[model samples]
Target: MTELPAGLHEFLSKAGWEGAEIDPIPGDASFRRYFRVRRPSGERAMLMHAPPPHEDPAPFLLVAQWLSNHGLRAPEILAQNPREGWVLTEDFGNDRMRDWLDENPDGEESAYAGAIDALVELHRQEPGPFSPYDMPTYLRETSLLTEWYAPAVGLDVDVSGYDAAWSEALEPMLARQKPGVTVLRDYHAENIMLLGDPRMGAPQGLIDFQDALVGHPAYDLVSLLQDARRDVSEDLERAMLSRYAGRAGANEHFEADYARLGAQRNAKIVGIFTRLYKRDGKPRYLDMIPRVWAAMERDLAHPALGPVADWFARNIPDDLRKSGGGTIK
Candidate 1:
C-alpha cells in the first residue's frame, strides 16, 4: 500500500493492533474507503479512510451519536481524527440484509420483514438536528436528472419544462405525507443488517444513514419498497406500505401521497441512472433504467398525481415508449 497518514500506523500499533494484520475491505458508496484492523486482544475494528479535504466525517459521527441516543444500534467512535478525517469504529459483523437475501433468494419476504421492522423502530424514535433528508434531496437528486437531457443525449431539454413540471407535481404531494419523522433517504437493501435479536427476534442494524431527513413518512417507504436494483413485487410492496402506515397512524391520504412520491422518486432515479452512464462512465446504472421506468410508469397511472400524469403522457418522448425506456433521442 502507499504511505498512510502520519500517525495512522503508529496509532493503531499503539492501540494494540499488530503490524501483520491489516486488510482492506470492500466499501459501500461514497468517497471514503474502509479497512479492518485486528487488535492483540483479537477484537476487530473498522478504520474509515477518508482523504482529508473532501469527505467530512463530522455529520456522520454526529448523526451516529444522535441515533444511538435514540436507542438504535450505531457504531461507537473508538478513535478519531477530526482534522485528517479518519475514525475507528466497532465492527457490528458482516451479515447485512441484502447479502443474506442474495445468498437465499427464496427468503426475501421473511428477511425483508426484519428490514422493515428496523425502519418502523427508527421512525418511532424522536427527532434530532441536521436533517440529512429534506428539500436538498429535491435540488441534489432532481438536478441529476436534468443533466441526462443535455445535448449528449441528443434531446435538448435545454428548457425548464422538467423543472417547473417536477416542482408542480411533487411539492403538493410531498406536503400531503404525514410529516415530522426521521426519514433515511437511502434505506434500501444494502444499508440494513438483519441482526436477529435474542429477546425481540429479527431486529435490524442500520448503516449509511448520514442522509436522514425530517420529512414525510412516505419517503422511507418509497426508499425501501421501490428499490431500483430489484423489484419488491406489487403485493409485498403494498403489504410493507400498509405496515408503515399502520405504525405511523397515517390515513388514506397518506397512502395516496406514497404512490405520488414513489412516482416522483423513481422519475428522478431514472434521470440519475442515465446521468451516471453519460457523465460518470458507469454503464451498470443504465441496466436499472427499465426497472425504474416501470415503477414510475406504475406511479404515473395513479389518480392522485393527475397533473404530472398529464404532463408525462404528453411530454415523455414518444420514442422512449417504443424503445422500452431508451433515451429520448
Candidate 2:
C-alpha cells in the first residue's frame, strides 16, 4: 500500500475514522489530493489534502457552507484541520456529469437542462461574501494567453493592443455584473456530480468551487456550456443558453456577455493549460487547448468582441491560432 501523508492517521483517528481503508482518487490541475476514506463500519467520506504554501482548504470550506446553506448539494464537512490542510467531507460518489454523459449519450439534453436549472437556482440566491470578479482580475486572466502561450509559440504579440481591445469590449459585460452574483468560476461538467434525476432542474453535487467569485451571472453559464474538458454540441449550447435566458429573465445583452466571457475564459484556459504542460510537466493538458481555441474562435465572432477579435486577427496569425500554440513542443 502507498504510504499516507504526515499526520494522516492522527487526523483520521480524531475524526473517528480510525483504521479506515483510504484509497487515492484522481486529482485535477491543482496541488490538492483526494482520498476515499472507507471506515471499518462501512461509512464513506472524502479526505482532501491541500498542502500549505500551495493550497488552502479555507475557501473550499467557506464556499461549501454557503452552497449548502443555499439549498445546493455541496458536500457536508464532517471534520477538518484547515491549518494542516486536511478535510473530511461526505462522499459525492463517482457519477460525474462528464463521465455519465459519455456513457449515456442519449441523456445529454436532460442532463444539460438540469445543469442549467441548477445555475438558475444559484443565481436566484443573494450574492456570497467574496471578492468581485472585476476588470483587473479578468484582464490578468486573459493576459495569460499572451504571457505563456505566445512565448511558447514564438509569436510576438502586441500586448498593449490586446489589453486595450479587451478593456473596450468587456465594458458592457462588466456593467451588467454590478452588484454581482456568486459566480462559481470553475462550474463545468467535470466539477458537477449527477446525484439525483437527470431530468430538468435535477440536483447536482457541486465541487471544485474554492475559487468562486462574485461576478456576472452569465459567467458560470458560459463556463458550463463552453466546457473545455469535453465537447458540448452547438445545438445543446444554444438550447441551454436560451433556457437560461428565458428562466433568468436575461435581457438583450446576455448573449453578448456570454460571448465576451466565453472568449475571455477560453483565452485564459489556453494559457493555463499551456503553463501546466510547459512548467508543471503535465503534458496531458495541452490536448485540451485545441478545443478551447475553437470555442474562443466562436466567441470572438460575436459583435461584442469586435475590438478583441480585431486584436487577435492582427497579432495572432491564422495558422498559429489554428494550432492553439500547443504543437510547439
Instruction: Return the top candidate by lDDT.
Output: 2
Model 1 CA deviation exceeding 4 Å by range: 1-7, 14-20, 132-140, 149-152, 174-179, 197-200, 322-324, 327-329
Model 2: worst 10 consecutive residues (lDDT sum) = 320-329
Tens digits of lDDT, candidate 1, 1-329: 44455667866765556472677776433567778887657788888766567788887788788888988887888887756677788886787766777776777777666666667777787656755344556645665655664344565453366666666666765555334677767888777776663224566667787767677767778888889977689999988766766665777677667777787688678777776676667777777787887887777777777776676666557667445476533
TM-score of each: 0.87, 0.97
TM-score attained by model 1: 0.87
* Candidate 2 lDDT over residue span 160-234, tens digit each: 999999999998777789788999999999999998659645578999999999999989988998999999989
In model 2, pairs of residues that clash are: none
